[model samples]
Target chain A: MKFLHTSDWHLGRQFHNVSLLDDQKVVLNQITAYLQDNKVDAVVIAGDIYDRSVPPTAAIELMNQFVETVCGELGVPIILIPGNHDGAERLGFASKQMKGAGLHILSNFADMVTPVIISSDIGPVAFYGMPYNDPELVRHHFKQSVSSHDDAHKLLCDEIKTHFNAEHKNVLISHCFVDGAIESESERPLSIGGSDRVSHEHFVDFDYVALGHLHQPQKKGEEYIRYSGSLMKYSFSEQHQKKGMTLVEFDEQGFRSATHIDLVAPHQMRIIEGELDTIIEQGKTDPNNEDYLLVRLMDKHAILNPMDKLRAVYPNVLHLEKPGMLIGMEQEMASAKLARSETDMFRDFFLEAQNSELSEEQDKAISDIIKQLSQQ
Target chain B: MKFLHTSDWHLGRQFHNVSLLDDQKVVLNQITAYLQDNKVDAVVIAGDIYDRSVPPTAAIELMNQFVETVCGELGVPIILIPGNHDGAERLGFASKQMKGAGLHILSNFADMVTPVIISSDIGPVAFYGMPYNDPELVRHHFKQSVSSHDDAHKLLCDEIKTHFNAEHKNVLISHCFVDGAIESESERPLSIGGSDRVSHEHFVDFDYVALGHLHQPQKKGEEYIRYSGSLMKYSFSEQHQKKGMTLVEFDEQGFRSATHIDLVAPHQMRIIEGELDTIIEQGKTDPNNEDYLLVRLMDKHAILNPMDKLRAVYPNVLHLEKPGMLIGMEQEMASAKLARSETDMFRDFFLEAQNSELSEEQDKAISDIIKQLSQQ
Candidate 1:
């Protein structure tokens, strides 16, 4: 049985303030082409089809169109799981009804392991989908004293192994930040608060483990365990890495070789340093002319609507910086301890420009927030 | 054709700041009893199943249970129309799929005249469901150079007559507020500012016009046209009126008699007149002991924790109130007016409470709203 393995579409995502929708479209179109040529059995999206938990209508529409094209037009079964970025309950809404149309969406973690068995020529192929599970839920399901991510994940893997039989081919799909994997510097981690991360040991027993939630595409262990990577290079850190999905073919003899396919980023994001006028002129005649460009002006003074002028030639110009970037400004202010209390600083900056002045009671609330931030 | 004509359930209605859910349940149970005894061929609801477009989850669940009991459990075909109170777009959702389960929901104005034909032992009955039409939409639909409520309604009635053959046994269900009909003070009018009022003449052609929207059960022009009223007396104004639904039964010859099935208000809402201290003292031995009750204190001064005290004896007390009820609050502050302006007020109130002063630009925006209000 053959299937196209792809994940982390992140439909409405902005890469460092630049909309990656066009680049994403380019890669998806290539996947569609590949599917048509190869006559694949199924398309598996591990997780994170959207950037936010509550995706915009446009993003939902885009996903609908893609699913319609693959499942409805091409007649391939599409299986999906919800990732950390997705709201599981929302994604899981009416999933049972949607299954009649052959679009399988698994978001419920109530079942320790729910497998969608596909009847193939060789035998029934059990495609197991596990969404990103919270430890509390895992503990409730297992009814044991599991606390941390590692303990819960190990228990989950052990339970999955118990469900497995040697006769049927079993494939595992998951979304978690795996340890000992290469990290893309520009890729933002799923959670800044440590609880979201799960150890890679959970996927050890599966015949073929398809993983997601990491932008950099690479195999976790031998080739059997893999990260299909993001459809497109989302950031400058991923500029050097080849971006695309992995096509996997599995037979009754355990697993077959997986192939990685590369795709060109539709409009490469580039940063150019110069005066505002020169930067705008350079933006107008750049080789990657249609690309979303971020200009960092070396001039001391801020340019008036530099984005507006640059967009006359390059409509996708996302960001403009005068002299120093926001990160640079933060670094400069790093030595100023307390800084008139963090809330007072915010009240003095963003709100002050909007003609906002806090009352004594409001100031107290703001100061409380500052104290919390200081503790963090 | 044996058919039960009921409308305007308003499942989650609050009357004079009191919940009417228990009252609604009592009425529904009565209707269920009537349906079983009468052995009704079909059930027709003329719209407004909920008071608010986005009803509370409990309201939705209750409505679903009612549908299950009537349609699924009792094996009766149910036909529903969208009312002025309902979000037509939301009601129309999954309607296509729901048709297979014998529950028909009509939401669009496009199906204005086409009768939903249902077969029965007598003959074929054409059930025409006309949703409340705004004058602007009616004008747009017919491409007529008319604006008045009378004119738009005349156009709709013409469309109905033109399409419908009076030769067949026909039942018309409508949700509209018309002139020359007595209205309860609590009834929400279909339109506030610009909508034209529909004339009562529209029902002249039909054998029986099952009217909705007006909570008070009343007849106009003859016994043939009637308002089913609400399942319960939804407001203080409706307290004196006998609240229930009307069941219309048609014979082989066509014209038949209509009977009113009285539904007991589940929990009695009594305006107990006395001093607050007297009522509190009387509560010790006052052994009427109904599960749900609404106590009204005659004391001029506001009673602190009145709900808590009243709830101690009457655990199911929906609301507690002072003697003087705010009159015309529903009519004066129309939903559309409140919906648009309430957000602005909330935002301004928040900023002001924070001691945030508005700039000239912000002040101008606020002034513009004040100007609009002054002009109105």
Candidate 2:
């Protein structure tokens, strides 16, 4: 069986307050074209289909169009699961009725026990979808002593394993932070104090484990375990990561080869640092000036309306910073000691208040008042 | 052909900060039971299926369950339109694909021109659904001169009339305030300055017009034009309004009798007025004390923690108002003139400052100060 593995679509995500719907549409269209050209059997979206629990109307419409084009128009069976960002109940609405249309969405914990068996040329492939689960809710639902995410996942996976048949090859699809996996700024922390991660060893029995929630495409200790990563670069931290989908070809015999396909994003994210004048000059001639940017200026002097000036050339600049300002601030803190003495402090106060050194007559008047106050 | 007409589900509505999901479930279950018992050919939801454009997770689950039970389980065709509260695009997401499962949702103006034909024992009943359309958007979409909501509805109805066949009996479903229709507090004003209302005469060609947006069940001048009201009492203003579904029986030639079926709500809304003590006494003895309540106290004296006291008996008291406080305020306003005189105002100020009436010594001192000031 050949299947395309993808995850973390985050359809309604905004990049630094800018809507990414158009960019997402471009990439989704690319994926749809790939699906049409390739001889793929099915598609498996691990999790994080939406950026939020309540997506905006435009996001909902985009997702509807994408799903319709992939599963409805392409006639490919797609299996989906809910990630930590999604509200499982909302994502799973009408899921049962939608399965007949080849869009299988598994969000309920009970549904995780039964595998969706799809027939292939070699034999049948049993696909198990485990959605993101809250440890507290899992504990209450199962009446178990699972206190952490790892324990809850293990318990859930063990229960699912019991229903697995040895006759057919099994594939487990999930959305979780696996132990020793790389993290990114965009992926929300599943729990406080880093106790949400589960061990990758739990899925050793499965032929392949397609994971999500880590926006980096890389294999774990085994080649069969991999993170399909996000559909696009959601943060500056993920700028170095190659965004793409993973394809796996397997059958009843067990393991097979997997291929990674890189997706071309509509726009790239870049970080640039230099003196304000130099950066402005560079921005004028830069080939990728339209890319989203985060700039840091090293000039000591303050630049007037820096953002407006930068945006004249780099229209997509999202953030601007001045590292030299912090250095100047530290120096100003050291010079503040001169204002600690009463007379010198008064002189400094006069200079600061008046935005200049006080005149000779004004200084004399201040000294006379100080003398009178001392006498009192 | 026989059909059940309903609207204003407001599935995710909150009353006095309390979730109405359970109450909505009760009413929807009643409607479901009614459909199973009756020989209805189809079901039409005029509009306002949700309280907000982005409904809560529970509301989405409730709506999905309702649609599944009606269309999937009961095998009945259901047609729905979007109301002013709903984001039309979001509500209509996947609607085109959903039609294959006997569920028709019309949200766009273009779709409103076509009718959803349902074959019945008598003949084919053509159901035209017009979702809530902003006057500006309607003007732009049709590229016509429609300034007010009436003009938009008239133009839309005229377009829909062009598609109507003389052979089939037509039913028009819409979500707009009809001219001269009575409204309740629960219904949101469709537009500013009441320009959102449309004339009922626009639907003269249709055999039956199922309208929504007004939470009062009443026929407009014509018996064929009606509003099904909301699924439940969403506010105290609707305390007297009987919430239910309208069942219509008709043929291809003309209209038949329509019946209003009252739905028994899990909790009724009530408003009570009396003295605090009397209200408490009544609350303790009233048979329907558990119902949601708005209490008005007539006691002339202040009551301590009146809401807490009332809740002990009537646990669901949502609001409390003191009518006697207004009368006391008026009396205080009349007496405030005594403080206008300089001597009396000084005395009152002294009394307030000391939290007690002025002493004879203080009064004499104030009089001496006033005499000295006047002479100066």
Candidate 3:
């Protein structure tokens, strides 16, 4: 079976108040284009299809367009699960209805046992989806003592094992924070008061574990257990990580080859660091000026409407970071203010109010008033 | 052709701060029950499936469930249009994908001309949907002088006519406010400044005109033209009108019979009017006290915690109206203040402040003080 493994779409997410719908659309079109040419048996979406429970209408429309082109038109079956970001009930709404159309959504705990078995050369590869569920839900479902995500996931895998056939190769699709996996600024924490970390050992029993919840494309203890990563760089922290999907090809022997296919965003996410003037001067001849940028200024002095000036050159500059420069500038100003005498401070204020410096006699009278106050 | 016509679901709507989801689910269950037993050729939702453009996640789930049950499990075709309340772009998502599964969402201006032809007993019933569109859309669509809704709709119908086959028995499923239809509080005004009303003559040529946008169920200029009404009573203004769907049966010639089937709600909505004590007394013995109620208090005197007291008996009381009693009390208080002498008013104030009556000397001193102040 050749499976296109991708996850953590985070549709409807806004970056620093700017809508990512246009960026998302461009990336999704690229995904659909790959599906159009590739003879992929199925597409496995690990989880986190949406950024939130209630996505905006445009995001919903984009998802619709993607599925219509991939599943409806391209005739590829998509296996999906709901991540912590998605509303399980909302995402799983028409699972049965859309199943016949090759959109298999494994969101409910009750139906987790029933796998989406697609026939491949390696025999039927059974796809199991374990959507991100809380410990409370896990406890209620299995009547087991589940205090953490680890306990919940272990119990879930145990249940799936009783139903899963040992003869067939199984691909476990899940969305959870596994131990040893890296974290990103974009991923919402699974739990607040308790640990949501699940051990990767529990999933290693399966032939392959397709995971989500982290944005970086990396493997677990074993190379077979992998996170295909998100479609785009969701945060500045993820600027260095190349976003992509995993295309897994298998034969009769099973686990033949898994390759990382890099997906490109129309506008690259970059952190441009330099003095404000240097960056602006570079932008004058810079070919990639339109890329989404976070400028880190090394300048010690304050600038007026720095963002406006930067945007005049680099139109897509999203954020301006001063780093330690602001604190250093503030300390310098504080010391300079302390070094000046109170009379000099008064003279400065007088100068500011009258648009001129105080006269020598006026300054002397202010000093005499200060001396008298000091005596009292 | 037999068509089960319904409209104005208004999902995600809240009545007087209380969610109507439970009520909506109850009525939807009833509709699905009817569909389960009857041979419904096609289900036509005229428009307004949701109460707002971006509905709550729960509302989206409900819509998903409804479509899955109707089009997926029941194997029936549903033709729907986006009304003024729905975001056309959001609702129209996956239209092409779900078309084969029998959920036809006619939301786009470009797709409005293309009819969903379902073969019925009489012939192919060409269902033409005209979603509630503003004048701007109409003007942009046709590049014509479409200044008002009337001009817009006339042009739209003209466009549909050009593509529509004359031989087919056409059913115009629209969400426009016809000139002669009755209005209700729940129905949103289609236009802000100009008239949204389209002439009945513009739609007279169709075999049967199924309309929405008006909450009250009634026939328009002709017998064939009708509003199926909303699924439930959305407002207290519709207290008297029986909420239901229209079942239109057709023959070889044209429309044979159009019957209105009444739908029942779990908790009946009612407006109770009387004094608070009497209503409470009635509620003491009333079995249907849990029904949603809007009480009109006729008590002239001030009643302490009247709503709290009424809710003790009728737990589902949503609103309590004082009506003319508050106005009357305010007027009485104003007149009583006018009639009272200055000294009398001061004595009353003194008594209120000290929780004791003012002495004759104190009252006389106050009067003397007031006279001195007036002279000054």
Candidate 4:
């Protein structure tokens, strides 16, 4: 059985407050093309189908279009699970009826104990989907003493294992923060610190575990456990990470090989740092000039209308910063805060404002004014 | 072709600030039972499936369940359209894909020109659905001079007539205000006055025009042009209106009989009027005491704690009004305004307050105080 594994589409996501629907459309179209060319039998979307619980209408429409094109137009079965970002009940609506169209959205944990079995050339592949479950809900549902995400996942997985058939290949799809997995700023924290992280040892029994909630495409200790990552770079921290889908091929033997297919983004996210004049000159001749940019100016003096000037050259420049000003301001703020008295702080403010210390006569006048105000 | 026609479901509607989801479930369950017992060929929902463009999550879930029961469980085709309260584009999303499951939702003006042909025992019944189109959108889509909803509907119907087939029975399902149709407060006015009213003559080409937007089950000029009304009473004004679904039986020959199937509401809406004491006394023994009540007190004097007392006997009392207070207050306000000067008004207020004319000593004291206040 051959299947395409992907997750965290975040369809209605905004990059630097700009709507990424158009960009998402371009990348999703690319995935559809790949699906057609590869002739993949099925698709597994681990989770995080939307950027927020109540996504924008445009995002809903875009998702509907994508699902229609993939499952309806291409005739490929799609198994989807709700992520931490989705409103599970809302996304789960009409899911039972949608199964006839080959679009399976698994959201409820109680109904998810049974796997959605699909027949393949070799045998049947049982796809077990686990929607993002809060520890409290999991604990109550299973009547277990699970206090953390790791505990909940372990309990749920163990229960699911009981229903597993030894004769067929079993694939588990879930959205969880696996321990030791690389993190990115774009992915929302499932819990504080690493309490939500589930160790890869829990999933050793499964043939393959397609995971989400980590925006880096990499294997976690084992080749069978992987994160397909986000379809596009969602933050500056993710600029170095390669974004793509993971394709896994399986047979009757239960284990199989997995391959990563890189997706081409319409615009690359780049960080460029230099003096204002030099950066502007570079932008004029740079081959990737149209890429969404975060420019860091190293010049000592503050540049006037910096964003305006940078945008004139790099239209897609999303952010501008002066590292020198940031560092200098941080030091100044610390020293200014260290001033013990209001008078001393005022003196420092005067010196900073006028580029000179307060004169003796001026200080006397300020003291007299303070005395008058205090007397009233 | 026999079909169950219903409209103005307003599934997420609230009555007197109270959610009607539980009540809606009861009525919908009744409809489901009717479908099961009668074994209807199909169901036609004219429009207004949701109370608002963006309905609450529970409403979405209810609508999903209803569709699943009818289309998936019962294996019946359902034709739906968008109402004025609905966001047409959002509701229309995935409509093309939904058709495969026998759930057809027509929302766009451009895409709805062609009829959705369904095979029947007699022959084929061409069902044309016209979603609620604003006058501006209608004019732009067809490039016609439509200033009012009436003009828009006329132009659109004329266009639809061009595609009509004489051999098949043509049924037009639309969410529109037909002229001469009685209305209830629950129905939102499409436009000010009667500008939105489209004459029944426009839909003469169709064998039957199942209409919506008027929350009253009545015919407009002709027997074939009718409004099925809402599934439940959404307002006090609709309490007297019979709420039900319309059952129509048709064939290739065209004109057929239509019957109204009354729905039993979980809680009937009632208006009780009389003196507060008398109303409360009556409520104690009334068989319909549990019904949603709108109390109109006819007491000549002010009654304290009327709502609290009434609620003890009738828990569902939603509104309380003293008609006598309103009349007396309006008369007093008009007379009070006749006192042009502040002093004169104060003098009249004193007379009303004290139930006596001012004495010379009091008048002298009032003048002294007014003079001192004016000086300040």
Per-residue CA lDDT of model 3 for A1-376, tens digit only, reads: 7999999999999998888889989988888889888889999998888898777878888898888889988999989999998888777765676777888888888658899999876689999999889899999978889999999989999989888786788889999888878888888889875498889989878888899988999998888889999989999888899998999887776677789998988888899998888999999999989999999998887888999999999999999899748877898999998899788888888988999877889989999998888789
Query: What lDDT would candidate 3 get against the real structure?
Result: 0.87
Judged by DockQ cut-offs, is candidate 4 incorrect, acceptable, medium or high?
A: acceptable
| DockQ values of all predictions | 0.06, 0.34, 0.34, 0.42
The weakest ten consecutive residues by lDDT in model 4 chain A span A337-346
- Per-prediction CA RMSD (Å): 14.8, 7.2, 6.9, 6.7
Residue A297, model 1: lDDT of: 67
Tell me the interface RMSD of every candidate, in Å: 5.4, 2.0, 2.6, 2.1
Ranking by lDDT, best first?
Answer: 3, 2, 4, 1
- Indicate the DockQ of the complex predicted as candidate 4: 0.42
Candidate 4 or 1, higher TM-score: 4
Ranking by DockQ: 4, 3, 2, 1
Estimate the TM-score for candidate 3. 0.87
- Candidate 1 chain A minimal-lDDT segment of 10 residues: A92-101
What Cα-based lDDT does every candidate model obtain?
0.72, 0.87, 0.87, 0.86
Model 1 chain B TM at 0.76
Model 2 accuracy (lDDT, Cα):
0.87
True contacts kept of each: 0.00, 0.40, 0.44, 0.40
Q: Looking at model 3 chain A, which ten-residue stretch has the lowest summed lDDT?
A: A90-99
Better of 2 and 4 by DockQ: 4
